[model samples]
Target: MKKFWKWTNLTESNPTERILTLNGTIAEESWFDDDITPQLFKSELNSCSGNITVWINSPGGDCVAAAQIYNMLMDYKGNVTVKIDGIAASAASVIAMAGNNVMMSPVSMLMIHNPATVAMGDHNEMQKAIEMLEEVKESIINAYEIKTGMSRAKLARLMEEETWMNAKKAVELGFADSIIEPDKKINEDEKEKNKASDSILFSRRAVSVALQNKLKSHYLANAGANTGTDITDLEKRLNLLKP
Candidate 1:
């Protein structure tokens, strides 16, 4: 099982500064149905104090669990900085709202949409479900409104459309405090990777940006996974389906 939360500060010598990673799903592994309850999360969090840095990459999970984590970070005595290195969508976006300073990587994404669940029942049950979903959505708006100060009506519209935002858009929308700046110093190896990476974009990233709206959003294979739906694969599949 992958550990969703871990203390990243290898040397635990300083209580005043801490680093933690909140990667993968917000709470646990969905494919395996693994669980990380709020109670257990608190047990780990209670030990840390002062400024904390959290690295997030999640497709999101149980809203209740995310709510607990969000509240925990919001109420923490010291500063909390959140860095979105990949994707933060659904409940993970809720958690992102808790950050005192939320920074998104250059190409990272922050997605916001209506909450959903599986319900099995009849007319009365369906009405009850709708009512419940409406209330849950209102609660979610509270987080977004606090962070962005956007009007409820506008926020509702964005949620209804399942908005997908890149780092720039995220900051412009007030969902992110700022875009992360590239490190000033990079070794030769790192510089080589950066220099070569963009030269080969056509082989991987061409048109992926424009197609983000087409797919809404695809779940991260796992928290740390950076792979996206390849355009070639998508085109091939569409060709097959049309015939």
Candidate 2:
């Protein structure tokens, strides 16, 4: 699901220190199919007109979208800090690196991977795709090298491996400045509650019956798991059957 960009401040009365949060896949179009524009981000920064903090939690998406966002952030004059609340993968990682100071949540993730593309038809099409991908790779590599002060070659290798770095690892690599530890007790309490809910739901007789049939027939036959249509149908049936 695509989350909306949420804006907030540390304090209510003194709201000069603005925060813009980017959560979910950083695609050309959001999961809801809404178009993303550099103008929208620029407008947000302009509205803040103070020290800005960008909170990132994304799986990354279009290179063009990433590039536009990167350029906008780099151009902004005020201090820009990035707090990684969850995962910043691919282009989202590029945006995170633009921050003047990058902070990561203790349990958050940062990922980088080589650029990929799909092409059809002849040799020319394949060659064009390769060239385009190389350019995209260079752009992404430049962002990491500039932020982390790491060697381009080294960054390239890490990206090639599709590295998934935890908060501590990100700080060690200079991709993040510090790890922000949240209230662990609160998180643990939430987890315990969620576990109880899951246990109760999964123990239901109807759920067990559905799972058995799914595992034996539908899931076994379709090993690859084509989900959308069948899942929607099942959900509709279950909803209709509910008293």
Candidate 3:
């Protein structure tokens, strides 16, 4: 299925102040979703009246749409600042660079990769797809270089490897400026440990049940309720779902 962009304003401090937000996939289709955003961006630029804040949280969708937005931001005379509240991946990362000053949450992530395309056809069709992808990659790489002042070769390598950088790494690599402190400290390591424990516990229960059935088959024994297998499975599943 073709992906379409989504946008919604989560917060607006003052009614009179102009704050334009574009959230979700930054694809070409997003322009059609609501011409209001693009028009507002243009209007603000033409007016050159107030500072504009653009908040972006997206996985990124289309390249063409991103380029259009980037150009508009570059043309604007007013102050432009971009905030990355959640994530800015793929083309969205490029859009984030449009901001005169970019801010990313400490836990936020930014990702970049060579442009991708899907195709189903013969060798010629496959070759065409590869060529298109290469061209798109070049365009994206150029944009990154312009924004981060990074070497084209290095950025291209990072894109080729589909690098995902967190806020700290982003700042270190010059993709982002500063890390905004969140209300609460996040411990991703603890979360990952809990996830691994749950997975292992579930697998143990599943294997235990199979073993129980084998024992019963050979000994003509009934595995009573609250057997090791049942208790283990119940406890494991419950623990896994708990908040």
Candidate 4:
């Protein structure tokens, strides 16, 4: 059975954080296949106790599997932080809602739309399929509402419109808590240092200008005392030294 998730300890010794990477399609196993089950996922999840950081990069598949994974993450004892490093669409977005803190890479995207399925039947059977899809959509919206605190009506509309969000838009709409900007602290520190350097440079320039003025005044006074050098020559010499 193909596994969609991989677990890794972030640190080798006395690790305090774990990483769960969910890439590609959510569940590769056939729906009827029991080889790769949520129970197996749960066992792996419970193998260790630590904060979990889930990195997701999926186009989504198997809503049922996604739902089970979402529930398991929600029930986990440690804090769950979800980082969307690529696109999380459809059912994948539902799973993202399980995070206590959801973050997205600056270039990552998230998409939501109504659930779809193939159905071949008479009018009555077609109606049943439609009804089932509607119910599934509502179930997906439940997860969105819990995460975003948006009204059901609004969430439904967004799903209907197939809303797509970048990291900034996701944060603005409460779909994500923040953007995953690497080296943010280091960038901020660099900015502070640049500001300090600029201030010092400005101060040095001011001192240089003040000293130039003082020297010019003293030279002018000396020229006046000597009364021999032409005033134009003295002015030209001072101008040559002007900053």
Task: Name the candidate that leads on TM-score.
Answer: 4
| Model 1 per-residue lDDT tens digits across residues 138-180 | 9999999999999999888788767788877788778998878
What are the lDDT scores of the predictions, listed in order? Answer: 0.76, 0.75, 0.70, 0.83
Per-residue accuracy of model 3 over 76-108 as CA lDDT, tens digit each = 776778888888988899888887888887668
Q: Tally clashes: model 4.
A: 0
Model 1 deviation from native, Cα RMSD in Å? 11.4
Model 3: CA > 4 A from native: 1-17, 28-48, 182-243
The best candidate in terms of lDDT: 4
Candidate 1 residue 39 C-alpha distance from true site, Å: 1.6
Comparing 2 and 4 on TM-score, the stronger one? 4
Give per-residue CA lDDT, model 4, range 1-243, as digits (tens): 788889997767648999999999988776434645777899999999989999999999998888889999999999999999998998899999999999998779898888998899799999999999999998999999999999999888788767777777788778899878676565767656533123211122345457767866776788747657665675678568643
Tens-digit lDDT track for model 2 on 1-243?
A: 333467785557657788788887675464223354555656766775778889898898876777777888888888998999988988899989889999988778888888887789799998998999988899899999998999999888787657877777788888889877576556777656533123210113345457556745774477576655565566567566543
Q: List TM-scores for all candidates, in order.
A: 0.71, 0.69, 0.63, 0.73
Give the Cα error of residue 38 in candidate 3, in Å. Answer: 5.8
> How much lDDT does candidate 4 score?
0.83
Ten contiguous residues minimizing lDDT sum, candidate 2: 195-204
User: Candidate 3 — which pairs collide?
Assistant: none
lDDT at 58 for candidate 4? 96
- What's the residue-level lDDT of 187 in candidate 2? 73
Better of 1 and 2 by lDDT: 1
lDDT of 2 at 107: 75
